[model samples]
Target chain A: MSKDAFRARLEGTAAAIESLLDRLLSSSPMPGEIARPPRVLDAMRYAMLGGGKRLRPHLVVETARLFGREDEGVLRAAAAVECVHGYSLVHDDLPAMDDDELRRGKPTVHRAFDVATAILAGDGLLTLAFDMLADTPTDPDPAVRIALVLALSRASGLGGMVGGQMLDLEAEGRFAADGKPIAGSEEDTLRLQAMKTGAILAASVDMGAIIGRAEDSQRNALAAYGRALGQAFQVADDLLDAEGEADLVGKATGKDAARGKATLVSLYGVDGARSRLRRLVDEARDSLTAFGPAGDALARTAVFVAERQS
Target chain B: MSKDAFRARLEGTAAAIESLLDRLLSSSPMPGEIARPPRVLDAMRYAMLGGGKRLRPHLVVETARLFGREDEGVLRAAAAVECVHGYSLVHDDLPAMDDDELRRGKPTVHRAFDVATAILAGDGLLTLAFDMLADTPTDPDPAVRIALVLALSRASGLGGMVGGQMLDLEAEGRFAADGKPIAGSEEDTLRLQAMKTGAILAASVDMGAIIGRAEDSQRNALAAYGRALGQAFQVADDLLDAEGEADLVGKATGKDAARGKATLVSLYGVDGARSRLRRLVDEARDSLTAFGPAGDALARTAVFVAERQS
Candidate 1:
């Protein structure tokens, strides 16, 4: 697929996911509830809508499409994943966490709203994500719906994204229980990155595979593709932080080095990080070989990850 | 059952739940991982273990017992509910939220740990609750597990506890979007209390009923019972806050009135609140009439709720 074609596909999927999310966020999860808390709803919408490449949703859609299933089910599942993504970003940007003030070319949720509202907004989004997955529209089969919930819970839960965040916080010298610095080996950094970001992105693909009821072999291959792409995405992100213009990157650039955050880019330097990103993108593309051209959009996504400025 | 018998049963259940929770909190949710972030794990354990009334879990057990099923399934489900309760308290006590320094006789998670770790610890516990529900040991039937997941997500999500919490925060004059005081009518206070505390406690009973596969009539009865009991519990709690000593209550008292946080007790006055509490307890006991003597302990629980000093 051409880069333009992939961009168009990605854009369309993102638009669809955004519209669905807008409606989902606007309404109360409990139908009979009197009102949606306006402040939290606004914060949730501000964080979620009109932003980013929608790369995770794109992964969910393309992976499902490769399995010959592209419909409302995948769309709903994709939207749920994006909610989790948005919630993480909101929490990550909190004054207590990464202390990021900007995200996606706008003030972060905490900056846009008060810290209390930002926290509730993150909580609301996180809770609603599971609600969306379990609601009947996500799947006809209760078993399949349950599978999605389980997979998402594992991906987002402790030992996954949340645990990774805990490690990231420790690495920042925030709350080291034993009074020791956590910034250690490159392996530690890689492991932290995998948990913090890779888990959810990989789960985005894995969730689609589960929804599509992919065979074990197909599921494993897609999961591998997702994990590789996720790592590549992180490396590319770090590279952007190291070298890209601050305005083009949306948030502050060079903040990772400023915070002494251990990253692949920091350890390997720019040229080495770029090489690693290339190898990862290749691995991602190779994992999708069994699907032939059906995997074309996903392969292009890997390429885009390596090349995008932000 | 006599008051002594009920007290014994409640004590036994709390102890069992505590032991189960201690084990659950100590182990890494993901085994073989390099290391669980020690600080977050410690905060999670600290917040969850050695604490308050296991009233929610007891409700699960008693409600499930009404259907003649008493086993690991209810225990797991009950433990999951408690985890949600514990996590909510951790987040609620954050400096950005209620700003409570003490909870259950110790420093709140945010005070014991830092704000960032407290947030992550809450996040970790919330994620772990769903993970517990989804794990195979929670239920043998995938359909049953899915039902539990859906029920829990609804109970804890946007329209439920979190939404109630958002309302509670707004009432405190924190981030009311319209910049108006949210301390409104008694009806509004009841609604807020219902969403905040009542929802999850009610969910605890409903979850047990679902796991027990209670008949529709029984399920509705138990759910109604739970809702009434939850409201009664809240009123009783407010009474404690208004009238009890700090040392006995394990936290500061009279802060509710000082903060101008509307409550049923404040709306109706102490005597009126006590009368309403009696009526709710009666309603709770009446809902269990079909089970006769089998519900004696639950009936006793209602009495206990109204009469307990703490």
Candidate 2:
């Protein structure tokens, strides 16, 4: 496809993903006026709805299309994963956690609301994802749903994103750890990045695949796509942190080094990080070969990750 | 049976709950360091292992026995419920939330560890409970397991514990408002208490019924037991806060009114609250009549909840 064609597809896909997000956010059944609550819900809605590429949902849709089914059932599950992703970001930026006061060109959830509400809102969103998935019993066998639940839980819990966080907490200000150096080889850099960002991204794909009834081989390929794409996505985030415009990025930029945070560029330098990002995108696209022609969204998303400006 | 026989069952059941709590704490499939993150894990173990009544887990086992099956499966479900209950307390005591620096005669989790770790530790336990229930699929069908997942999520999320919290937050100075005596009725007070401490207590029984194959009538009865038990439980807690010894209660005592916190006594006079407590207990025990002889543990538990000291 031409650049224009791909761009149009991305815009249409982003719109579709936004509508799904709207369903997820608007569906909360909790009645309001919580403690005169300082507009916590407003903060939560602002952080989540104001900005997101929805790449994860897009991947879910593309992978489901490989199975030749694009029903609401599949889309809802896709949306649930995206909600989790949104929740993580909101909480990650909390004063007690990452402490950023800006998100998506708006006040961060914690700043807009209180820290307590931001924390609860993040928690509400996380539990809501599991609830949404568990509510739909499309998988007839008790075993399949069990597997899907386990997959998502493992991805979200201590061994995945949360675990990565513990690692981040421990590794901050360290010279070189987890086989990755402050200036290390590509693989070493990836090992560090994988635990930090790669695990959830990979789990996001496998979760959607298992629920959408992807075959074992397809699931494996999806996993491969997830790892490659996740690293590229992280590298792009690092690049944005290094050189992106504040207004365009919609978040406070240039804090990666200021906070002494670990990133590919921090480990491997900016040029090396850029080179590795291209390599990751190439491999991520190659992993889509198993999807034949049905992997267009996954492939296009990888390219977008490598080239994203902010 | 005499009091001796009843005491034996209570001790044995409490021991069983303790064993399950320890096993879950140390034996998850996650790597040791990842599963048990030092002080955070210690705080979780301490808060859960403290010598309390083991009220919720006992309800699960007794209710499961009510249905004539109390095997590994039911105990596992029971254990899972305790995990959720224990974890909620850990997070609820965090500085960002309730800010309790002490609990159950020991330091609170956030005070024991840091606030961030306490928050994540609680999250780990919450998801771990559902993961356990969802993984063991021998009894509850996918549909039923699906229901259990939804039920637990709702109980833990804003609609239940968190919703009650919002009320607790709103009710915080509600009594002293404008110095105009006290406002709201006994009905409103009961509803508030039911949501706060009562919802999950009730959920413990409702969950047992859901997982143990109880009939609709039995389930309804158990739910009533839970609601009434939860109310009585809250009332007992309130009484302790008013009149119990600090050492006896294992935490600060008589701090509720001094703190201007929400309690039945805060809404109604002390005499009125006492009378209401009696009525709630009667109603709670009355709900168990449908269970025939299967509800002995539940009946005894309701009485204990109404009158227990610390």
Candidate 3:
């Protein structure tokens, strides 16, 4: 697949995700709900729609397509992952967390809404993610729906994304006895990054496999692909922060180093980090050997992760 | 059933929930997880265990027992409800929310840990609630597990508890156009209380029915009981906050009025609120007509809600 074809596929999936999210976050309440407060609903819609690369959902769609499964259930699952991703961003941008004022070129949820509304919006999104997965529209099979919920909760829960965020805060010396920043070893950085960022990204691909009902070997292969791709994506993001222009990145840049955030880029020089990015991208593509030409788009995505300007 | 018997049963279920939560929030990482950061794990455990009445879990246990589910799975489901309740309290006590320094006779999670840790702790507990439900131990049948997840998420998500919190904030005039507190109508208070405090309480009973595989009529009856019981519980809670001593209630009293919180008590005055509480408790028990002797414990619980000193 050419770069343009991959970009078009990615953009198509992003648009679909946006539409699904809009419908999910609509003002009307679903069955079993009392009422949807308009203000919080608006904040949730603001946090989710019209933002980000939608990379996780793109991975879900592409990987499911790899296994010859493409349907509404796939889109629902993709939207669910995006909800978790969006919720994490909202919470991470709160006054207590990263305190980011701008996200995807718009004010962060807390900046757009109040702190309390932002908190509830993030909570709503996180809870709704599981709700969407467990709904029959996500999958006809109860087992499969339960599987998706289990996978998602594990990826986003204590030992995964949330834990990763806590570790990141601790590394910033938020909990240190002397109140000074703590520097982590390279191994610690790798583990933290995998939990914080890699777990959810990998789960997005694994969820597609679950929806596709892939064979164990196929699932494992795709998971390997996802792991490498996740790592490469993070290293690429760190690189963007280190070298890319703030206007192009759509958020403040170079703040990571200033906050003493432990990143692979800080441990490795730009040249070394770039080489590692290349190696991971190769590994990502190599794991797609089972899919042959069908894996071309995913292979290109790995390249996109490595070479994208933002 | 005697008051002592009901108290013993409640304590037994609470102990069981505490034990289950301890195991679930243990430091050892579960499958598919990289590592559970110690600080976050501690914060999660701190937030969940060693506090509160465990009223939600007691509701689950009794309601499940009212049918025929009396096993480990029932305990697991109950624990999941408690986790959601715990997470809500943790978030509600945040500096940006109610900013309460203490809860249940101890410092709030945000006070014990930093705001960032408290936020992540709440996030972790909330995610784990779904995880515990989705796990096979919660129910051997995947369909039952999915039902539990769907019901719990709806109760706690956008149009439920989270949405209720948002409405509560709005009612406090947090978003008032003229920068003044908004005085909500009686209807608004009723809806807000139902969503904020009543949804999850009702879910506790409804979840028990789901676990017990109650017939549609039986489930509906239990739901009615839950709805009335939840309203009664909240009214009693407000009464306690209005009149009980801080030492006995385990937190500051009368803060609701100070914050201009929209509660039934505010709309009805002390005597009227008490009368309404009695009426709700009667309604709760009236909904249990089908169970007769089997629902004796639940009937007693309603009286407890209305009459308990703390």
Which of candidates 1 and 3 is the stronger one according to TM-score?
A: 3
Off by over 4 Å in 2: A1-17, A20-43, A137-144, A173-192, B27-47, B137-140, B173-188
Fnat per model, in the order given? 0.55, 0.32, 0.91
**Candidate numbers sorted by TM-score from highest down:** 3, 1, 2
lDDT of 1 by residue, A166-248 (tens): 88887876665664555657989988888888888888998989898999999989988988998998999889888999998
List each candidate's DockQ score: 0.59, 0.39, 0.91
Off by over 4 Å in 1: A32-34, A176-182, B29-35, B176-182
Docking quality tier of candidate 1?
A: medium
Instruction: Put down candidate 3 lDDT per residue, B1-310, tens digits, no spaces.
Output: 8889998998899888888888888888999888999988998898888856798999999999987788999999998998899899999899888889988889999889889999999999999999999999888999999999998999999989999988877887877877566888988888998999899999999999999999999999999999999899889988998898999988899888888776778889999999999899999999998998999999999998888777
Please write out the lDDT profile of model 2 over residues B1-310, one tens digit for every residue. Answer: 3556656777777888788778767745453122333444555676678566777778877887877777776777777777778777876676766678777777887776666667667766776777767765425566666667767776766566655655555455432446332344667566666666777787788778887788887787777778778878887788878888988778888777776665777666678778878998889878988776656667777777777777
Any idea what lDDT model 3 has?
0.91
Per-candidate RMSD vs. true structure? Answer: 2.0, 4.1, 1.2
Q: Count the backbone clashes (under 3 Å) in each candidate.
A: 0, 2, 0
- Which window of 10 residues has the lowest lDDT sum in candidate 2 chain B? B31-40
Q: lDDT tens string, model 3, A161-223?
A: 999998888888877887666888999999989999999999999999999899999999999
- Name the 10 consecutive residues with the lowest summed lDDT in model 2 chain A: A31-40
Report fnat, model 1.
0.55
